[model samples]
Target: MEMEKYFRVDKLPHIWCPGCGHGSVMMSIVKGIDKMGWDPEKVTVVSGIGCSSRAPGYMNFNTLHTVHGRPIAFATGIKLANPELHVIVITGDGDGAAIGGNHLIHACRRNIGINVVLFNNQIYGMTSGQYSPMTPEGSMATTSPYGNIEPPFDLCELTRSAGANFVARGTVYHLPKLDSYIEKAFGKEGFSYVEAISQCPTYYGRRNKMKTPLEMLEWQKKNSIDIKKARDLDSEQLKGKIITGIFAERDDEEYTARYDQLIKSVQGGKE
Candidate 1:
C-alpha cells in the first residue's frame, strides 16, 4: 500500500512474535503519517523498550529507541527543543503505563504538542509474559500464574482527565478505526493520546487460553463498543466491554507555544 518507502528495507523482518498485533498498530501510525503527507525528515518517532518499541527501527524517519518506560520524557524534550518537529511516541503498556505513567500524565497536563500511541498488548510480550498495568484482572501471565488480581488502567479516561487535547482508543481488529484515530491525533494541536489495543498471542493469549492471534482478535471485536453507543448502556451492560472512540478533544493552548510566548514576553520587557 505504498508503505514500503516508509520503512527501512534493511530492517525488513521485525523481531515481533508471530501473529503479534503490534505490527498492525505500527502500520496504522505509518498510514496516518503518510496520509497527512508529512515529511519523513520533519517527523520523529520515539519509543521505549518493549515489543512495540521496535517499530521505530523499521520506520524510515528520525527515530529514537530510548530507555525502558521513558519515551514520553524523551519525546517531550524533543518537542520542546524543536517545536516544528512532529514527535510521535510509540510505547507499550508495560513501558508506558507502569514506570513511564508519571510522564504520560504530566505531558497530558502540560498539553505538549506530541502524539503518543500506546500499544496496549496487556502483557509484557518482550519480557517473557509478565503482567502489565493494562492487563485485565484475572488474566494469566508468566508473572501471574494464578491470574492477575490488579485491575487494568482505563488509559483513555486517564489521559482525558489529565488534560490531553485528544484521547482515543482503538483495537487492531478495528483497523480502519485505528487508522482514523491515529490520523486525528496527528492533526491535533496539543497533547494527543491513542490507545491501540493490541494482541500478544505468544504471551497474553497463550496464558489466557485464547491460544491464537485470530482468537484474540475475535475477542476484541466481541468485547469492543464505540463510545457513542457505550454512553447509552448501563454499567452492568458495559461491564467487560472495551469502550473505544475519542473520549476527549479540546482546543487548549499547547505547551511549546506557551513557552515561546513566555520567551517573547520576557524579551520584550527587557529594558
Candidate 2:
C-alpha cells in the first residue's frame, strides 16, 4: 500500500516551526494508519484550531478543521452518524485540555468509539506562548515571565478518571513506542486517548533555556519512564517526571454498541 497516496500536499508546507515535535507525532499517526491498511474512504480525521489542529488538512481522508477546542464534539457527531467509520481527533494541549476540557471529559464519559491523539507540547505554542493548562508549574512562558503559577493536569489520570476505555502516553523521542500506543488506541472499541508529549522549540525552548528543539527532545528522553517500571520509583524521584506507555485499558461496550443492543431489544419486545 502506498502511504503517500493518503496525504494532501496542497496544505503544505506545514505551519509547525522548524524541528517542532508535532511533525514527529504526525508521522506516527500516518504510520499507524498505514499499518492498519484502513480504507481512506472509511477514515475521517478531525481537528480544532491550533498548530496541531492543522494535521487533518495534510491527510487525503475525509477531514474536518473545526473551531478552536471543538474537535471532540465534531468527532462525536461523525462517529455517532456512522459508527463504522474510523474517527480520529487531533488536538493540542490547549485545544484539548484547556478551552475544550469539558468536551474531552464528556467524550470519555460517553465511552464513544473515537480515537483522540492529544499533542501535548506543555505550553500554548500558538497564541504567542501563553501558560496552557498543561504547562508545568514554575515553567517559564511568554505570559508567565516569572513562572507558571498553576499546577499542570496529569492527562493520563484525568482521562482514566473520566472513563476512557484506553489511555496511553508517549513522547516524540519514543517514536517506536508512540506508534505502538497509537495502533492500540485505533483498535480499541471505546474512547481511546493517546497523549503525545511533543516539544515546541521555537516558543517553549526559548523560554526554558533549552534553546534548541533537539535539546528539548533529549530532555524528554531522559525525564520519561516506562510505565511498567514507574511503580519502582520513589515519590520524590517520580515528581515532575512523565510515565510513558499504556496506563489504562478495559474491554467494554462502546456507547453506540450498547445503544444498538438496547434498540434491538426494544424492537423485539415479547409483549
Candidate 3:
C-alpha cells in the first residue's frame, strides 16, 4: 500500500536537513500507523518545539504542536479527556530529556496509555546545536566546544525504571526494526517509550568530526548491537555498544482503566 496516503502531501519537503534521520523515523511511524489502519480523526499526535516536533504538522491525523518540553503534559490531558483516542507524543532529546525530563519520567510512572516516539539526535539540532541530555560524553556541540563532561542518558533504562509498560530503542540505520518497535508501542496498554537515535549531520556531525551524514549513520551501524546478542556478552564487552530492542513490557492497568473502575465502584455504592 502507498504510505504517502497517510501523510498530508502539501506538507511535503519537511523542514529537516538532508540526511537527518528524523525523516526516516517519521516515515517508520507512518508505516506503523498504516499497519494499524486507524482512523486519522481518532489518533492524536502531540509534539513539542524541535525538529522532531515538526512531525505532527506533516501528518494528516489530529495534531497538537504544544509548548517546548510539554508535549507529554498535553498528551496526558488529551488521553485523560478521551480514553478511546490513540494519543502519541513526538519529542526530541533536548525537548524531552532536558527540559521535559520531569514530565517524561512522570508519564512513565503514571503508566498512561500514551505512545512516545522520542527522537534522540544527541545534540540540540533545533536551537542552534547545543549540548542535549542525550549527547554522548566527549561529543562536541556548540555548548560543549571542547567536549561534553556530562554522561548521556540511557533512555531505555530510565523509562523502564520510571515504570513504562513498554520501552524500546532503535536507530535510523535499522528501519525495519524501528517499524516493528513502533508497532509494538502502538499496541501497548500503558505508557510506551520508543527511542530513535537519529542523525544530525549538519550540527552534530560537523562538530564531532563526522563530516558527512553517511559517516554518522556508519558510526551507528558499527556501535549498535541487538539486545539478544548483548545478553551473550559481559558488561565490559557491551561497553560503547548501543543496545537495540524492547527493554521491557508489562500488562499493568492503564491509568484511565483504573480510574474508570474507581468511578464504577463509587456509582455502584450510590445505586
Off by over 4 Å in 2: 1-3, 269-271
Please give the distance, in angstroms, between residue 65's alpha carbon in candidate 3 and its true position after superposition: 0.4
Residue-level error in angstroms, candidate 1, position 37: 0.9
Ranking by lDDT: 1, 3, 2
Which model scores highest in TM-score?
Answer: 1
The residue-by-residue lDDT of candidate 1 on 1-271, one tens digit each, is: 5756799978878888899998899889999999999999999999999999999999999999999989999999999999999999999899999999999999999999999999999988887999989998899988888988898899899999999999999999999999999999999999999999999999899888799999999999999999999999998898768999999989999999999989889899664
- Model 1 scores what on Cα lDDT? 0.94
**Which 10 consecutive positions of candidate 2 have the poorest summed lDDT?**
1-10
lDDT of 3 by residue, 1-271 (tens): 5646678878788899999999999898988888888887899999999899999999888999999999999999999999999999999999999999999999999999999999989988988799988998888999888999998889899999999999999999988999999999998899999999899999999888897999999999999999989999997797667899999989888999988889889899564
lDDT winner among the candidates?
1
- lDDT for position 233 in model 3: 100
Displacement of residue 125 (Cα, Å) in model 3 is 0.4
TM-score of each: 0.97, 0.96, 0.96
Q: Model 2, 204: alpha-carbon shift in Å?
A: 0.4
TM-score of 1: 0.97
Clashes of 2: 0
List per-candidate RMSD values in Å: 1.4, 1.7, 1.4
Model 1: which ten-residue window has the lowest total lDDT?
1-10
User: Which regions of candidate 3 are displaced past 4 Å?
Assistant: 232-236, 269-271
Clashing pairs in model 2, backbone N/Cα/C closer than 3 A: none
